[model samples]
Target: MTTEAVLDIAVQALMVAAKLCAPVLVTALVIGLVVSLVQSMTQVQEVTLSFVPKALGAAIALVVTGHWMISTIVTFTTDLYTRMPALVGH
Candidate 1:
């Protein structure tokens, strides 16, 4: 494969990874920010106070987006496989 083809594949893989991770990462970030704000306001410095909510939020995000995420990855993989023969000039 040419360098350009390799770079294209790498870029596509990175984009797919970022798309898959975005939902859960955003959920956790939002939850953590809110928990931090509440902790600062209420002076509740408990570890679980911040941890539990962010974990639950991330879990909920994953649950909600799980099907879409799976379909997206499967589609990407299928497309990559379909393109492999051409990429390899076979």
Candidate 2:
């Protein structure tokens, strides 16, 4: 394959990865911010307080978004497989 084709595939893979990760990352970030604010307000800064909620938020995000994530990845994989012959021949 041409350099540009290879680069395109690489970029697409990166985008898919980022898309899959964004929900969990954003959930963790928002939860962490809220936990930080609460800790600041209450003067109760237990490490687990922040850690647990962010973890739970991430898990919840994964649970909520799991179907979409799987479908996206499956679509990408199917497309890649369908293109494999073309990609390998040249």
Candidate 3:
């Protein structure tokens, strides 16, 4: 309800979002870099060569971390809900 409370909620939401996205983002970044390196070394300048690996890596990352990501978001939501009354001074 207050400025500080609103800022706190906003920061927490952003943190949760970053935490949720980190795994897949990191995977894609790494995959892209590696694919680029391999393409350079082999002189294979195919778009799908880079794209497919990054996509598959991201998909695998999502699969591996999906449950944890869901649980983390659920926990954040539940905590936010639990603090709602206090946050609203109700």
**lDDT of each candidate versus the true structure:** 0.95, 0.95, 0.95
lDDT of 1 by residue, 1-90 (tens): 789989998999999999999999999999999999999999989999999998899999999999999999999999999989999998
TM values, all candidates: 0.97, 0.96, 0.97
Two-way TM-score contest, 1 vs 2, winner: 1
List the candidate 3 regions with Cα displacement exceeding 4 Å: none
Steric collisions counted per model:
0, 0, 0
lDDT of 2 by residue, 15-55 (tens): 99999999999999999999999999999979999999999
TM-score of model 3 (CA atoms): 0.97
Q: Model 3's lDDT to the true fold? A: 0.95
Q: Which residue pairs in candidate 3 have backbone atoms (N, alpha carbon, C) closer than 3 angstroms, thus clashing? A: none
- Displacement of residue 79 (Cα, Å) in model 1 is 0.6
In terms of lDDT, model 2 sits at: 0.95
Give the C-alpha lDDT of model 1: 0.95
State the weakest 10-residue window (summed lDDT) of model 1. Answer: 1-10
